[model samples]
Target: MAVLHPRVAPRRSTTRATTWWGKAWVRAVEEAAFSESDLVTARTLARGGHVGQITTRPGGFFASVEDQHGLWTVDGAIPELDETGTETVVEAVAAEAGRIAALLGGDLPHDLVEHTDEAGVELLPFGSELAATCTCEAWAEPCVHALAVLQQLAWLIEADPMVLLQLRGLAREDLLGRLHARRESPVSDDERDLDAAVEAALYAARLLDDPLS
Candidate 1:
């Protein structure tokens, strides 16, 4: 579980989503909203400091928010990556050795997400993948309060893309550890055989040249 301290409200000066991943997160949640007004109100609440401290667990985020209807508890849920999905994502990251370094440097490479998508694993929440419920008495599953939490979370994602991975159930340390282990693991028998064959061929060529010399 990761806890994020409250951010100073945007106060309508700057955009809420400062990064591409953060924008993608906002788009996902906004697409799930039942009404545009809900999104607008939620954005206002989030930017106005209506959302409180946020706690992010494996599958979701929890926070307190207030609006005209008063204070309410909001829980936002994003599906956790299954074991296969997690492995797929790790493989995608490992495909590009620098991806882990980029992530450690506070950058989320878009191609990494694209690679995961091609492998049928979504690193970002989409449509039904994002769900929420607010304590407020609203018919919508994700009421304004819930949307507010989602909005605030986008800001957090902008600051640290690791939050998105954590939401998908893998912490930064765990992901790095996995990548490091994968890199350090011994080569497969097939790879070893290929290497041996190439070495043998090179040695034969060198021997032939030595005789010519």
Candidate 2:
């Protein structure tokens, strides 16, 4: 799997999301907020171009961030979907072949976003499900540095929607392989054969544990 190296441009005064998926992802991170101060700090840090050495894994994203608050002591992590959750995601994708094609093409189709929501498949974190954690001194999350890293993530996904899938729980190739299996034998019924769907997705989901995948 290729590691997505985002061209974190400088002078990001504020976060922007033009695409539906990008908007949803940014909204989720903002929604997990405790105060506006965090957002402001994150924006400031991002503009100053302090976040760096960013890396993504199946389970989450991690990076080295810097700011006045922490000198040579900055790190953050954004966890993604879990194994059990991946099965549901696979099943949902199985029922929607067009969605797979769109993802394979690097487009996060609006219809697929709706389907994922309808099926309760969290390709990104929502509300209190999780928040970006950091090694900074801040007691709250989406801490300035962490938020900066997340903001960069927004840019990354905007460029390539498949990165969202990578964050969720599977690498593009592995997820594609599983999806190919689904195409060969479409899921008969999501509810009745949920077990089978999960089983089919198990191998790919397990690989999600691989760091920097």
TM-score top scorer: 1
Q: For residues 1-213, what per-residue lDDT tens digits would candidate 2 score against the true structure?
A: 547485475773556777887887778768876777777777677667787856776656777787665643334344566676676776666665455555655677776667667866656667565456677667776666777777777778887777777776677767656655654544455433433544544544557766455
Give the alpha-carbon lDDT of every model.
0.78, 0.66
In order, how many clashes per candidate? 0, 0
Regions of model 2 farther than 4 Å from truth: 1-4, 12-14, 69-84, 94-97, 183-213
Cα misplacement distance, residue 128 of candidate 2 (Å): 1.8
The sequence of per-residue lDDT tens digits that candidate 1 reaches over residues 1-213 is 575666546576654677889889889888988899998888888888888899997888898887776889988889899999988987876666556656756789999999999989989888678888888889997888888888888887887788889999987666756655554443776434433433443455468669764
| True-vs-predicted CA distance for residue 155, candidate 2, Å | 1.2
TM-score result, candidate 2: 0.72
Give each model a TM-score: 0.82, 0.72
Q: 150 in model 2: Cα distance from truth in Å? A: 1.1
lDDT of 2 at 143: 67
